[model samples]
Target chain A: MNIRVADDLTHAVGCIDVTHVSISLGEEAEAFEAVSDLSFAVTPGEFVCILGPSGCGKSTLLGAVAGHLKIGGGQLTVDGKPVLGPSPDRGIVFQQHTLFPWKRVRDNVAFGPKMRGVGKQERRRAADQILQLVGLSGFEHFYPSQLSGGMQQRVEIARVLINRPRVLLMDEPFGALDAQTRNMMQEVLLDIWTEIPTTTVFVTHDIDEALFLADRIVVMSARPGRIVEDLRLPFARPRVSDLVTDVEFVRLKRHVRGLLRQPEKAPQLARLDPLGVQEA
Target chain B: MKVIRCLIRGCSVLSCVALWQLASSLHANLGVITFRNVPPPTEVVESALALLKSPKLLAHVGSSLWRVFAGYGAAAVAGVAFGFAIGRSRAAGDLLLPPLELLRPIPAVAWIPLSILIFPSSELSMIFITFIGALFPIILNTIHGVANVDRRLVASARSLGGTSTAILFEVVLPAAAPSIVTGLAIGMGTSWFCLVTAEMISGQFGIGYYTWEAYTLQNYADIIVGMLIIGVLGMGSSWLLTTFGQALMPWRRAVETR
Candidate 1:
């Protein structure tokens, strides 16, 4: 995989753009091509969902944008600047709860800023604010082990948001939770997203989840993963908790499911480029 | 309920004493030879009481304690630093491990003669033996801890903008702590055992010195008493180490309770 930006392509105003991205894992036997020739632009404060079968590098794409993974081919530039490494501008929320067992909820949230050289006094204040935003106001001194699974995930989000990242990369963040708690977490995430309108890339396998949370859903395919479809979610902005019962949300879920079912044993998914290239 | 438990324990101790007396009476000649012919438990207790009152016991205990603290302390610090390096870096682990594995199997007490030859002072030699007793276990445990730390933790930290050094200190150390602490506890016990063996080298210090001196004099009662003292001190020190170590590990009992 190789990435080169044509010197003439002008930057879109206030959006994170990917110019012909191709991601590969390694030379190991049966080493699948993860993400292939995928490109999309996330506008400022855009909530985009990359939905696919498990292990198709949806998280890898997020990792690339977050500067955690090296881009084999593609430039993920935020605000006309290349992502160097994980800067405070790109905070990632992990699928499994990554709260450090040693630290209390408050200190865990305070970690990124503390690492980024924020003053102790100010970082603590910001941590408190983020904790409050994530609905963990009273759990400041509580350790991760003391909290339930749902609460632990909340701490994970609060920890990332404390840094005030411009792009929030979430990799199946609520996949481990029970259905009831997952839905509750979805609602909490929406509330948190509302307060700080960071452009979010949420990667998940759940069709209902993609519809519930995303502004645009990019359905991905197996193995040499490429965008199969980019379904623009018609659900209105500030997605409410009640949207689960919305008729359009059900239609959207069925529509995404139909697309997913078509590619189960298919030879390859036709690559999608919403800008110009209509078909193979 | 606590009193009843204590009373039961107390009764068990009394029963043990009674059995000892009963055995000694039945085999009077052998019982006399057991404490090297110093009569029985009654006579040994008298000698132990007399020795307890003497200031010599303090000097012996103090010197031994001092040697262990110096040696074990140095070993723990060095072991942890080097262990983290070996654990985190594949290059370093490969470079260092073969020699360490070779050196580790040689008993720490086996170093006493070589340590004496290498260090100018016997005092330093004893400390060196103690350090050897501890250093290997601590380093090996620490290395295993760091190397085998949860992969997700490293990835998660990387995703959160953590540098290699930051992840090593923050995530790796904390994750490997329980294993490292177990190594340290084992290392301390071994160090103490080596300390006693090392001080028996005609040095006029430590429990081993007193123990050897008692054997030469053949004051059988004192010899028995000395052995008992060493056992109790070793047990006491280990207990302290484990108790202190447990305070750092809140997760241990938490899992059991869970």
Candidate 2:
């Protein structure tokens, strides 16, 4: 399947507009604002990373955008339509272990089209193509539990990408990996993004990660999270692993670090999952 | 190491049998328990061999097997269906769980009288008792499994464009499988236990009935043979269930080996 045609690229979709969006997590009596009036716009095909301290609702914002969590106030829209619930148009990748353990790599990747009633052979073919793109061509029959952490994440990405999602929402997708694997995955992700060119919103706390992968970084304050800065990167496309050591990259990292180090009014809240506070 | 372990286990069982044989052969009488009327191991073995040669053995074994299968099959279907409904939907839980919870604690033996009254035939009553015996473990375990399914997996499935039905079949069902299989295995054991109890009380042609008949006839060796048969059947069925479960969830093996 042609993931993205030249004609479709000219009339690009996947523009995300978050206008004064506020989200409250937990039960009504115990509810607290996770994201407070977070406003940002990601233009079609732009790679935006939400960079923040832990529990700052960076992942929560991504959750709301992906339609897994509800927006309590204001509007969160993708491609000019309200995200009422999850759809194939918006595919999300959690940090780790979200891959279906029972499914083989190919079946897991093919789940999207299978849900869409795509024929078995066609979806498998599509899955293989996407798996190859994510550098997991030979391991299609391996169960998710059989694969390494990095390989599993690659399968996770391939699973999402098989839908040819209009927007890719990643919540610290490489956070669970070791340093070496994380860097390699960053390059691999960039390669896939280059080929697909979907509107991507990645959430990460690592400054170097945000600097290297994102076209624009939306930094936020802790607790009742709101945008502190929306810094644009000057780094060129197809960024190499060596870009993290570049002087400009280091300078931007320091600036972002300073923004995150500001004293919090409230104490650090427990880390909220992308699916919001789980009901006990 | 494995061979030695197996040998030790074999010796342990053999020693137990030897002890029993000595006690029964000598008519050993402890204060609380006595082997005065018990049959020796050799006599029990002879009785088992005689039963194997008799045509009545097939009729007894076949009836018990068929009853257990029918009751356990029904329990499996209903338990899983009820479990999925209760686990996934609050409305279903609120509506269905109260009566089930009330019935869950009542032992299958306790249901013998009521089941006999409720069903039109003794055969149906025996199956109902077996169903009751197996139902709780399967349902409770299924509920636990489905409820404990990682919310992230469901959220990801939904985000990937899976409909409610697709998510249930593709994601939730498979994720809950290992626990369900565990429940099924436990259920199989319980079903056999209940079937034997029901058979003894009401059956005309079952291994349980034969055991009861032997007790009435004072044929001590045949009673021991009947008990051994019941033990073997329970063990065999549980083994079958576990094997079936492992085949269903090949991923669990991968995780364990890794």
Candidate 3:
């Protein structure tokens, strides 16, 4: 399988800059701020995880970068270009595998290229190649409904990656999987990232998931989310499952947990979807 | 267990027929109803066999089948097209829905007089009534299906670089297919109902015309035969539609069986 590699010298392509961004959910009259005056920057090919409690608006922040949700204040830019609307250059993988149920796995993966007007044979070849990268080569002919949850998310990742996105945005992509499958997926994701080396911004409530996957973890506060801590991991590349037991890893996890803990007096906020307000 | 279930089903039908045979032979009458004028299963079978051997049987069945196909085919195309338009666009819905909603409540029987005037010939009028019978169910169901398509799927398709036209065809259409098929199956039944009613009123040859002709000629057994034939045709067509729908959606079967 042939995979395209990013040029070593052109470090400017996938850079993301978020400055004093705020987002609100629901109608104008009743709307509440989900993320308030947050700022972050990601260098090209860096894997950054947005770690937050439930309803902390981390996913909402990812949505702004993906150009799916509108920002109420401040600016978001990719490679010096202001974010506008959803673009294939920034691929997103939702927590639920948003694979087209009607399409076979091969077609689902091929969809991005097909939309770009690639011919049937060529796009299908690309789909097959990418499917192999995600360890789903043999399951091409199966429909999404036929695949297990882990396999479905694998296909979802492949579908997004086939676009060769400059920035891969994942909103808890393995959050729905069983603990065993989630662990395996986290490793599989790292392997894929090793191969393609795309800039990644992953959102998750799971502390271990954030610690395992990210080069840097941006921990966020509860609703009306503000950045509480930005921690850089010292652990070396090609991370293994056993790294979680490492003393440094455990210490950082504890520190991140403490950062995530909210004040007892603060009221719990209902979860907001990346797409803005949750429908009644 | 499967064989026993089949046997029980078969016996149930046989017993119903046996009861019908006993009632008709005895000329059973109650205050509100009578089986004296009704034809027995044995007489209906004989009449059905005689009609099957007659040359006119082909003409009657063929005309009915042709009218149904022509009217139903048109309804399916128009309904789905209109459904997609209305479901996707608020402007299209506002423009198209009011007149359709107004027209929907009028039964095919009520349309017979207006259609007879609107169409140049009786054949066209009967077909129009059949078209009317099918159109509303197909259109309404299609709209319902399209409107209910998961927003996430649409959002995903757009994020994947699908244009509006591509998204509508690839994502919205397939997502709403199961609902559209249900509409089509229901529409087929109503098409038969409307066609038969229209044919009885003015048709020269059709199953409905034959049934009405039999009543006027006092051939009550032939009426029962015509009714049975109509029932069988309706059942066969609905079965074909559902089977075709299932074949088109292989993914749905995998989900359902799982």
Positional deviation of residue A279's Cα in model 2 after best superposition, in angstroms: 11
Q: What is the lDDT of residue A128 in candidate 1?
A: 91
lDDT of 1 by residue, A1-280 (tens): 0111343335322368887787665456844456677788889778899998765667778877877666767787987888777665677777778788877788888878767667989989999988888888898987788889999999998887776666788888898899999999998998888887778989888998989999899998775677889888888867777888998888878878887775446565333221111134
User: Which model scores highest in DockQ?
Assistant: 2
Per-residue error at A143 for model 3, in Å?
1.0
Which candidate model has the greater DockQ, 2 or 3?
2
Q: After aligning candidate 3 to the native by TM-score, how far in Å is the CA of A3 from where it should be?
A: 14
Residue pairs with colliding backbones in model 2 are: none
TM-score of chain A of 3: 0.95
- Runs in model 1 lying further than 4 Å from the true structure: A1-14, A26-30, A262-280, B1-6, B25-39, B163-165, B246-258
**Which ranges of candidate 2 are over 4 A from the true structure?**
A1-9, A264-266, A278-280
DockQ of each: 0.33, 0.70, 0.60
Q: Model 3 — interface RMS deviation?
A: 3.1
What do the candidate models score in CA lDDT, each in turn? 0.79, 0.89, 0.91
**Weakest lDDT window of 10 consecutive positions for candidate 1 chain B:** B30-39
lDDT of 2 at A110: 90
DockQ of model 3 vs. true complex = 0.60
* Cα misplacement distance, residue A184 of candidate 1 (Å): 0.5
